[model samples]
Target: MFDQRKQDSLAAWHKLATQAQQWMDPEQQYDELLKAADEMEEKGLITSSEWRQLVRDAGSVFTGSQEHKTH
Candidate 1:
């Protein structure tokens, strides 16, 4: 079991929790997320292909859960 609600890694956990809550919010938009992805890509934190996948993931998140396609 988790020992505390706030931990040494609170920032990371908080980010994940916030995203999870937002994903379930009907009014939630990907504006900020897309912007962050763009910034990351521009800063070379993520490659072009990785950024494309991030965009794809955002689409899947907005359209409901994603189903992996069998090869």
Candidate 2:
């Protein structure tokens, strides 16, 4: 079973992701995600690998938003 800290981490990440999706500015969203990921990793809420994955996923969001903007 996952511990409290692990559960808290998942909850935090889920909240962040949901909020990021609602932002009108993709750059701002991506930046926020990176910042949050850094904070989470520093607090040991997420692993380095998870941080990398978050960054990669943020890039995808940024790119997709840009494409929509150009269309």
Candidate 3:
């Protein structure tokens, strides 16, 4: 059971990371990352805890992008 969950978490992270690299715009990437995380969770690809971690990580990463902030 723990092994299965570990696999799921790794898969989720890889998928989300790949999607994250598709967009150069931080805001758009953040939006799409959240959407992907939602889809992954809905499809049982990830646990809710994993989804929340992905959200928090993405938020912190993208939120720090220079392009995302207004001068």
Cα RMSDs of all predictions? 9.3, 2.6, 4.1
Tally clashing residue pairs in candidate 2: 0
lDDT agreement of model 3 with the native? 0.72
Model 1 TM-score is 0.54
Model 3 CA deviation exceeding 4 Å by range: 1-23, 67-71
- Give the per-residue lDDT of model 1 (tens digit) for 19-57: 654454522444545665676667566678877876676
Residue 41, candidate 1: C-alpha displacement in angstroms: 0.5
Top candidate when judged by lDDT against the true structure: 2
When summed lDDT is taken over every stretch of 10 residues in candidate 3, the lowest stretch is 14-23
lDDT by residue (6-57, candidate 3, tens digit) is 5776676656555655555777777777887887788787789988998897
**lDDT of all predictions:** 0.51, 0.75, 0.72
Give the winner by TM-score: 1 or 3.
3
Give Cα distance to truth, residue 35, candidate 2, Å: 0.6
Q: Which stretches of candidate 1 lie over 4 Å from their true place?
A: 1-28, 65-71
